[model samples]
Target: MFKEIIFKEDAINKPEKGRLPTSIAVLCGVTILALCTLLVGALISTQRHSEGLQQVVSSMLNKSGVENPVTAVLLNFRSYDTLLEIAVLLIVAIVMLPQATVSKSLSLIRVQQSADPGLIMSSLLRFLAPTLIIMGGYMLWTGAYSPGGAFQAGALIAGAGILIFTNVQYQVNMQSFAFRALLSIGLCIFILSGFAVALQTGQFLEYPQKYASAIILFIETAATVSIATTLLLLYLAVAGTQEEFNHDA
Candidate 1:
């Protein structure tokens, strides 16, 4: 007649895994507020100074030897900053460029994954690859007077290189001095030219007004080469370094 009944005690509410403790949440909120304040201050400062900067750039545009204000700033007025950028890329490339494995070909890059494209697709890629390189060259050449520049040229060229790489026939020799030279040429030329200018004018990278155009062209050319190769090397380091990867590992 007696049915055994089990009484269940009330369970304590558990804090959610996704929710932070109140103290931590408050701390994070305070940190975010501080960052927002700093960012707002920085924006205000930049806004206040930008008007003067634009006027200065406008006045000096002709002297910078480029029709494009952006290119003038990047490759002439503030070239050191661009040099530093390329140097950083060079460092990244050096870090990312893989050494040839014993089992792979004596090249820095190896095609770990193979693909057999249809004739039409293959022909299209081949056509596009060379076309991209030509476009990159045009971009580099036009940077002095137009909107394009070394970075744009490098990106376009890197795209072509990736297309070629994916065709499963690439075996780049990273161990070659020529390959490294191409990867570092931008930074090397930048530093050397800056020092050369300094030796003549007592200020590094202060290009003479007479030769500014030629110098900018030279630097951009070198930068395009290095930037493109470095970018490709970085992509290879990411995609080509492992067999399980979908690329040159």
Candidate 2:
């Protein structure tokens, strides 16, 4: 019953009236029109005023004290937009982690014995998970002063999660709200910290010179946590599971 719903065969009964050449021509026409529209929009948008805006941005960034100009703009002058961007990221995480529908046909399949992974995979994953997680931490911590940041760290940490999911018995699912909340907390903390900074100083996200490094550190830590959790959740959403948990065994 649920199989019919979950695995619907749409193409089997669907009408197929178009010839290959006609379909190809229609697709090419749409692509060409889209490219032309984009070209025209770009040409019209970048005028004299746009150049003035660019100069203003360059001047402001030039005066900023941050080592990374992009970070300075994102976390300082345009902080309000950054807040909304964080919110959007949280929303995307939430949307991606919804409960999956169970298929009845899948339930009918019997479990068969496969080659045992035994102690080797378990030991390897146990060793690798911590190592990768530590690497991620290091990457996040040095982002402000060095080459890595939250995204890079998160990706590294997610590699560990994938290893665990594939080689170990545990499985994380998109429908799990606890996991989603863990992912969202980092972004929430960041936004709240920014707001707190605003309260302390009249300007939004204006960190005092005395605590500049500390504030950036805190924000980066939060970003690292959130990014790692979100990426882990993304991996789980893509990697489905059917194994039952056996706590007593």
Candidate 3:
């Protein structure tokens, strides 16, 4: 106990490697200044380049096959970037998949304990889940014509799924083939669509203009489901490991 106290005293006496508050403040100020400078420069450069592209994109919008400019760019003009984005998300979901095996890792008793939702919470979740699901579906359908898209739709559905999963007594079975399939279906759809289009057009994801709208809709629909499932898995993985929640305060 004496040695521990002395060690703590020594630690308290140490001045964080001689980094004074003023020095630390200056370091942070410099970093902020540098970041602001870079950001300003990028904004200026982008503005200079983007001025001409507005009319160009507007002229080509009819050919891009989507009423929404953002969707056109993401799903049609530069789809490979979105493909890579989905692939990265899939990798993260796969890594977190094991933690979502609540049926295997958490005992039935603890699982029940962790799902200790009160009457109010259960009622709220019941209301929110259906509302969110409806909103997600609307958003997914509107992406081709409006600001809403797959990511936003997926996020909304994930929120619903999280509420339902955390507040309810149902345990997620990660071992189920359907669960894994849902987690990976987005990337698989993207890849298969890319290859199918490539076989016809000699370039991956280069959808023929006539079929672009349908193709984007199909891809976005599958991605929406996968995105929701993957995000739900992510939350489950973290929530399952927190044993303290099973105990009362």
Candidate 4:
């Protein structure tokens, strides 16, 4: 009798175990199907709207105060969108960074001391880093007339920073005042510029025709620095966490 009751209980629990997984699989399939339907609808709508996009671009370009259509679209016609995008990146960086604790200390420490990039990589970084800096600046400057902007320039600068971090022997303290300031500087400058413009023209981010180019250049330069610093800090945060984990183990 006891054995029969135990077997019956096992059988009942077996189905319950399977039910959870089955339900989860069904839920996932339904969710995916719904997402696919939404994506298709969005694509169809975009296709329908494609014809008028050029006309809209042309209409906005004249009042945008920039020669490059892309630049004008990003910095003048749709600047609020750009501001929100930067804020998103900044927020992500802030969220991903580890919180400070009383135990945390600032000091020069070696990263991946046992797994150095070796003499060849270290030597290459010396020449490569400066070149990337120059390229990044060039890209920032050319963004006014050509196919480059703050993002591209910032990426190049971040690449250079990564190389330096990996090849060199010092660890950066993300909590440092200067480092924190650099991380937020771009967004700060962008906001201040927007307010300044608003005060002058009674419209947010609406650059006066005479000062439009200068204002855009200033914003881009600050954005590049902010982007580079933020990216480098993100890299450091990941690496630092991993190193701490390994050390604890």
Best by TM-score: 3
Report the alpha-carbon TM-score of model 4 versus the true structure: 0.73
| TM-score (all chains, Cα) for each model | 0.73, 0.65, 0.77, 0.73
lDDT of 4 by residue, 182-245 (tens): 7788889999999999999999888898888889899989999989988887887777643553
User: Which pairs, if any, clash in model 2?
Assistant: 97-174
User: In model 3, what is the error at residue 60, expressed in angstroms?
Assistant: 1.6
Off by over 4 Å in 2: 1-19, 22-65, 100-127, 173-180, 242-249
- Candidate 4 residues lying further than 4 Å off, grouped into runs, are 1-50, 101-117, 241-249
Give Cα-based local distance difference scores for all models: 0.80, 0.65, 0.82, 0.79
Model 3, 9-88: lDDT tens per residue? 45656434534578777998999999999999989887455566678777888988899988988999889999999999
Worst 10 residues of 1 by lDDT: 240-249
Q: Give residue 111's error in model 3 in angstroms.
A: 11
Which candidate's lDDT is highest?
3
Q: Put the candidates in TM-score order, highest first.
A: 3, 1, 4, 2
